[model samples]
Target chain A: MDKFSLFVPNFLPCREYFDPGNNNACPGCGLALGVRHVYKAADKAMEKALWENISDTKFFGIKTNPSLLKIKQKKNELIICLDNEAGGSLRDALKKQMPGMAVAEGFKYVATACPSYPFDLYDKVKKALDTEGKSYIHILCPCPEGWQFDPENSVKAGFSAVETLAFPLYEAVCGFYTLTVKTAKPKKLSDYITIQGRFSGVTDSEIAEAGAIVDKEYSKLLEKIQSSYSYTFETTGKVY
Target chain B: MEASSGFLKKMIKCSLIEEGTAKPYKSGAHRKSLPEWDRDRCIKCGVCYIYCPDAAVYRLDDGFFDVENQKCKGCGICHSECWFGVISMVEER
Candidate 1:
């Protein structure tokens, strides 16, 4: 892990993932952009962690230890070797899975989003992909069609979301909680919703009530961030 | 040569696409605008490349960035992200 410091932010992976096909997502689609960003972050995480937890199998030659990447508490007596890459079973020989060799849980990833919070988005995703447990990064992606906002203003929508405390950027890792983005002066919830047609029907009083709810949520989150309290297993989601 | 009558040749019945390929030419057509890059203003920060959803902005061997016009959806994300104002989104005529 100490090798991580050698990584300079200027040094980004130019290697492209094998994109099987072009996406048919609508232009200015927030979901598409979110997926694209997540893909990039995960690719960079894999490329950066290229040197971590690598072992060899008798047949598979050189391969990453799946258990190390996965945070399962079970201790399997798996033999590891540096030279096993020399004769391991072809990993994708059938390019499929076998039911008999399955883990109790299927593969899953933590999910999260917003474009205004790109730095926050990238950081959280990279952490999620690199970390021990199932971590999720929640991004506030604005849809033009659904939100009734102009496509050009999609990015602005994201900005307004964070600015208004409609969505607070955060990450919870190893029972340690932290707010990634702290809005010094949160804008009005009305400001967050005024642009979107979906919220056009919302009355000012109702908006105020929502703002009160946001304030309560934000303060509770702030408490978590301030206290160095390490929560036990019950505080977080099930990781099995 | 034709196979012998008693012999059976097996082949995949489904279409198989070669992996790890990108087709920028197709989506490049439906775009409404294109990004223009200013070489002088660029700091080579790789920010443009990072923010572009299509991965159209690529860094060159000389450490400068350029766009793959066909693949770019002209979303203007690169234009918006460039700190040096090196990228400008120009409407397609």
Candidate 2:
């Protein structure tokens, strides 16, 4: 109601909302956790910056990666598109990742399950703020009351939600899709639902069916993310 | 007619609130478990800052992280998510 965008790149507002543990909320009630986690959702003063320098010789540069730098600087950086124009392969590979000289080409969509862990949520928000179009942040808010777990388990639930592949974290820009977070081992769907209180009555067959569905959706996401950029160098008439 | 006129008058007389003057929220009471941050063990990973629902964890000027006593509701998220074991949840007596 108050136009609150609580750094949506950050984790769920599940446990921070109600805080049943302290506020005379019902014992074993998880609604409190959701409320408690979000208590300061609107408080900007509390934003804990994860890093000292978010940019390369600049302050508050959200999209600092080589891919996004092109868009930020309004410059057409040379891509290692052609093999002949490029130097020896081994030397090029090392310097390519060294910054400033990296290839900033194509559309990238990053899907990471755990926000602010391997990635910086502040940078993500800054990037969204700097961008000119309508952007959407999708957060999976679990109701401990409905999920039927200990209030403290909300964070665990979020981690497992990503690991189980039940809920995939992805960001799509324009038409490009990227899965930022990749789980080493995808757990079973039942493993995710078993901890929640509402899914207790689900049978094994139903879980198996749902498992197949999750796998299907995961593959579909990967397919979209794998979509590549095709470009031809005019001088060499080479397609890359 | 009178009510409508009054509403218009109020809108015209409205004053703007200053920005960045918000007070810290005092919500420490009623918390079941409080997070005790070990300043020495902290790796400054900012993990507590990210997972904290209430945004209670603050990054101090010296690169050290600390919790605001007034704003914390004892959610324990910071404690659970901290990889360095810097924050431990102690029950409120």
TM-score of 1: 0.61
Across B48-78, the per-residue lDDT of candidate 2 in tens digits comes to: 7666555567678886677777667776667
What is the C-alpha lDDT profile of model 1 across A90-187, one tens digit per residue?
A: 22211112111111122123322465555556666665555553343344456667677766566777778778875666555544455667778878
lDDT of 2 by residue, A1-240 (tens): 112332332343322332322344332222333333323232231242121232443312334322111112122111111111112221221121221111122223221223323233333333443445433233344445556677566677767877888666665554455555678888877777789776677788877777777777678667755653221234445432
| True-structure RMSD, every candidate | 14.9, 16.9
- How high is each candidate's TM-score? 0.61, 0.54
Lowest summed-lDDT stretch of 10 residues in model 2 chain B? B16-25
Evaluate every candidate with DockQ and list the scores. Answer: 0.17, 0.11
Instruction: Indicate the residue-level lDDT of A96 in model 1.
Output: 17
Instruction: Give all candidates' CA lDDT scores.
Output: 0.55, 0.48
Regions of model 2 farther than 4 Å from truth: A1-121, A228-240, B1-25, B60-64
